[model samples]
Structure formats: C-alpha cells, structure tokens
Target chain A: MNAVRRRALLAVPVAAAVARDVAAQPAVEEDFAAAERAILAGRTPVAGGIAIDMPQLSENGNSVDLAIKVESAMTATDHVTAIHILAEKNPVPRVARFALSPRAGRAEVATRIRLATTQTILVLAETSTGQVHRASRDVIVILGACVDGG
Target chain B: MIGRPAAALLACAALGTLAAASEIRPSRDFLSPELRAQQDDPSRHPGWLWVEEGEALWRRGEASCQSCHGDIAGMAGVAARYPAVAADGVLLNLEGRIERCRTQHQAQRAFGYESEPLLSLTAAVALRSRGMPVSVAVDGPAAPFVEAGRRFYETRQGQLNLACTQCHDENAGRRLRGDVISNGLGTGYPAYRLEWNALGSLHRRLRACSLGVRATQFDFGSPEYLALELYLASRANGLPIEAPGLRR
Candidate 1:
C-alpha cells in the first residue's frame, strides 16, 4: 500500500474511538439552558439554608440517591411547600417534585434519582412564604443514565 | 523474654485474634457516619419506599401473600436463614424464595429482579428478620452449595482478573476511587444503593462489581449469582440482618 494510504488506514481505528467518545457525551448545554430558563422564568433563587446531600462522584447514573433539607419552622407559616429536582444534563431536566406540609414535621426529603451525565443537579425549594431557595451539586457519573441494565 | 503470666496473656491474645479473624461483621460497620445514621432511621431510609409498596401489594393482590401467611409477623427472623437448601436441593436466597412463592403459590407473575415491586417485596420480607443474626445452614445437604459459593469467591475473572476478596476482603474499608469498599456481605440486601438511586438486589450489586472489573456479568437469578450470594451470606453468618439498607 502507498505510505499515505497506510497512514490513513492506521488512523481509522483512532478516529472511530474518538468519534465514539464524542457521541457518548451528547450536547447537554442546550438541554441544561432550556431547563434552567423554564424553571427560573424570572425569579432569581437565593442560595441559602438549603442542603443537597448526594455523592460527589456517582459510579452509575441510573440511580443516585438525593436528600434535600430546607431550614424551616414547620409551623403554619415559614415552611417549605414544594421542592423541585432538576438534572441539567438529563433528557428531561425535571427529575422529581416533592410537596411538603407542616405535618411532614421536618422539611427533609430523601429519594433516588436518575442522572444522564456528569453535570450539576439543581434543587429548588419554595416556602409557604414567598421565599425561594436553591442548591446545586456537581456529580461525575461513570455510567450515564438510561442504560440497559442487562 | 516475657514472664510466665505475660506469656500466657500473649497466648490468649493470639487466640482472640484468631477467633476474630473467623468472625464477620455487618456492612453497617463500614458505612460512613452519615450513611449509617440514615440506614438506622426508618423515615429517612429510601428503602422503606419499596417496603411500603411491598406491604401494599401483599395486602391488596388477589392472591395475596397475606392469604397464605397471615400476620406478616410470622415472617420474623425468616430472612436470617436464607440462601437455604430448597426441597429439590437448589440453593435459594430471599429474592429467589419470593420468586418461587409468587410463581408456585400465588400463581401470579413474578416481579422482575431489581424491579420496584420485587425490591419492595423482598425488602418487606427481609425487614421481618431485621436485627436477627444470619444463620444459613452450611452443613449436611447445604455443604456442597456453600463450597461452590466459596470457590466462586476465590476464583478471579474478567480482564482485571481480580477475585472478590482482592478488593472486598483484602482492601475493605479502603477507598476504591471515591467509595469505600466494604466486606462482601449479604445481610443488607434489597438495599437502596445511592449509586443506583433505587432499591436493588444483592445480585445487581454483584453484577456491578463484575462489570467494574470488566468481567462477564452473570444474568440475574443465574446459578452463579446464587452461589456468590450464598458465599457472601456465609461470610456474614453472625452479622445481624439489615435489609432495606442504605448504602452510598
């Protein structure tokens, strides 16, 4: 074979591997931006008194446990009413929404969620009052979400 | 160089160490303080979500488990003796037993492994045995099965060629990447793994390990997985059952 042809042939496998890697990481920016825009609308979320508990690194993204706790008195007033979990990179940014009441005793919610890729998880909480609080966690997912468990 | 009493004490200490070596502790011992606390709290435990669903399914189904086994309390301490030898000489874990009951007795479709319903039912059944000591039979007819399980544990597979013990036994309590590797135990199965974000069976966790090492994963409910489950249960023989465990 000609030298140039041989060189091109050798690069074929390398090119294919690079292509696969790029394909694995889909364009998450647009999804993230769209999700953020829809959720925020115009209200600026203040970051305070809300704790997001989750692993910094997730070995698998199919299921990742998350805990959200908002500081509240749990009285008739000054209580968290709803919490929204959004995964910036997931096909559907809105993962779960939990409604709470004073009867819940504590403004704490814990559950598992799916993450699509290595990205930030945004948690927004609304209190009985007009206050809005937000928190986000960056997770590195080794196995992206929505994989065939088989 | 030691005196007689000192030498005798030293001998006792050596014996204690040997005894401790044979004793197995629960996975709870290795959990981080925060995760351990979460597992202890019922309301906070994510696994309970499945357990609740399982309870509902048990009471509501046409062929309800309650019909055959009334007052779920009868199930107490049952999970502690799992991966037992069935009548046909097959070893069956708690999940396997649930599958059998569903197909044979209930005449209902068995829930898929790692599926929400299966996990919930398994968790509920296992919760009946919470705090009970693991005591699977490894003698008489059960001997060969336990031996098979031990052999699998020792055998290395996958491209990494790493045995279960290489990380879980030899390097337990140490970090493998960002997570701590606990001693391989089957006590807290139907566990809610933070990485899974859902309740999962011991088999799913084992399969994850197989994949992590680039080894071939055994199909769910496969004999190979059953053997490994038995081996792990045997290793955790004295540990308390902690089903519906929370793990990160």
Candidate 2:
C-alpha cells in the first residue's frame, strides 16, 4: 500500500476512537451544563473574585466540608447578592444557593455537602451591581468500604 | 545465662511493659487534618445536623426530654458512663437507655435500632458528654458482659478468620486499603461516619465490622453487641468522648 493510504487508514481508527469517547461522555456532564445555564440566566460569569475552600481529597463522597468566599464590599450598592454551588458530577448538580445582602456583612458560607463522585465544583457569586463571578475546585472522593448500607 | 523460668519471667515482664506503653488514642487522631478540623467545627460538621434534630426532638411533645430532664446539658457525663448496668439489672448502652426511656418513661413506641430520632437523640446526649472521659463499669453486674465482650474481641470468627485484635490491636495506625486502621475505641460514637453520611451508634459500626469480616451480623441492640460495647468502652476508660465525631 502507498504510505499516504496506510497513514489515512490509521487515522480512520484514531478518529473512530475519538468519536467513541465523545459519545461516551457521561450524561451528568449535560446535567451540569443545564444547571449552570439555569444559574447563569443568560449572563456570562467572569472567572475570579470568588474562592472555594474544600479538601482536595475526600475520604468519602458522603459528606464533604465546603466553604465559598466572594470578594465584595459589603455595602448596599456593591455587595454580593447571591451564591450558587454546583457539583459537576453529582446526580443533582445544583448543590445549594444562598441569597444574601449587605446585611450579611460578608459573602462567605461554609457547609457540609455530599459529592456523588470525584468531580469539579463550581461556585458562582452575583453582586448587587449585576456582575457575576465564578470559581471552581476539583475534589477526589474515595469510595467507602461499607457502602452496602447494611 | 538465665534459667528457663527466669527467661520466661523476663519475657512476660517485657510483654507487660509493652502493653502498658500502648496509649489509648482517639480515632480523630487517625483522620486527616481536614476531617479532624471538621469534627471540631459545629457549623462545618454534618454530625451537628443530627444534633440539631436531636435538640428539637428533645423538646417535642408534652412528654419531652426537656420536660423531665430539664436542660439537656444536665445529663453531662451520662454518656461517658454508658453501657452500664441499669437499675433493673439490664446492661444498656446509651442507645438502649434512650430506647428504654422513650418506651417506658414516655409511654411511646420503640424507635427501633438506628432510627433517625434515636441516632439524633443519642448524638445530642453524647455531644453533651464530649471531652469527658469514658468511664463504663466493667465490674459488678457488668463483669460477665464485659468478659463476653472481651472473648468476642479476641475470638477469630467470620470467613476471614480474623479477630478484632488482628487489625485494630496489632495493626492499628496501618493502612487498610485507602483508609488508616484506628485503635478500636468506642469513645467517638454516635459519631458521624463519612461512609454512612449520617451519625451512627457504635453498634451500627460493630455491625459494619462484622459484615466486613463476613461474620454473623448481629441485630443493632443485640445483647452480644451491648456486651461488646461495654468492653470497648471499658477499654477506652479515660479517653474523652468525641460523640457526634466526624469519622471516615
């Protein structure tokens, strides 16, 4: 066979493998996309002014401590208005949403949440001036030994 | 060179000293620093969710725990001394005692084992005893039960043919897959286990261990587990209770 034809034949299998992988992407990814879109509400969220504090490795997916902080001036005119948490791979990607005001004094919240698997978590914060900021973190959740729930 | 008897005596003495030097460490010490910190902060601790439920349950109905016991804090040190022989001579762990109170005192139905209300109330009560040393009595009427528990701990059972001592005693502080094996102390139960994602009793944990070893899983409040709970508590004699503890 000609060298060009041989290379083209090899590329066909490689292309098929790539197509297979794209088709094999989990449905949860689409779930996350939809959830994120719902939260964004047609507005683009800029990546910054927000931070997520959580363990990089979680011993179990059951309950993980998470904290989100948004950089904002706590004033009536320039405060954080809301915070939304999204887990990219959880059955329900929307983890929580907290509505706040200048009365909150700070755009910080800490809580324990369940992660369905090892996945990226996104945090979005909305300011009083209609600006949206975002941050994300990846957590590796190890499966528990006794998950039979016996 | 020493005589045979003298050599045996020396060996025994060495073993005794080794046993004496094995300090009792809380399971929290085995957890990652992040989990350890989670256990300390109520706002960040999922166990507090159960404790909060327990607090509300404590005041529910006319025959509430608060109506009889006044402030729940008044029961401090009570959890630290559980798996004790009750007035009626029945050996009872904290959960058993709570169950008894609900049924006999409150004229209510049994909450059954591992029930949410039971776990909540047990955790709430145990939270009050946090930092107090576990002081379950292994003597008196509790003697036979404790002895049975010790036997259960030492005996090799299940398909794995492993005794509790094999791992928790001899191989503690070592890795068991992705997790570290902790010294088997019950001080931190009615703890919130990340595995269970909820607060659970030491009995539930014991049942999980039984299942892990492929042994006969006992009922939640079985006498066998009650005896085991007493023995474990006695072993933990002076370790501070970390009930509603966060555990992996």
Which regions of candidate 2 deviate over 4 angstroms? A1-29, A33-45, A74-77, A128-130, B1-21, B52-70, B87-89, B102-109
Best by TM-score: 2
Per-residue lDDT tens digits for candidate 2, residues B166-221, read 88878889877567888888888988876555688888889878867778889989
The positional error of residue A131 in candidate 1, measured at the CA in angstroms, is 9.3
Q: After superposing candidate 1, which stretches have Cα over 4 Å from the reference?
A: A1-150, B1-23, B112-115
- Evaluate every candidate with DockQ and list the scores: 0.13, 0.19
- Model 2 has an lDDT value of 0.78
Error of 2 at A28 (Å): 9.9
Cα-based TM-score, every candidate: 0.68, 0.78
lDDT of 1 by residue, A1-150 (tens): 011111211222355435433443445544656766666667788897899989887655545668888899988887889888888766667778899999999999988776656789998888888777888889876532212132
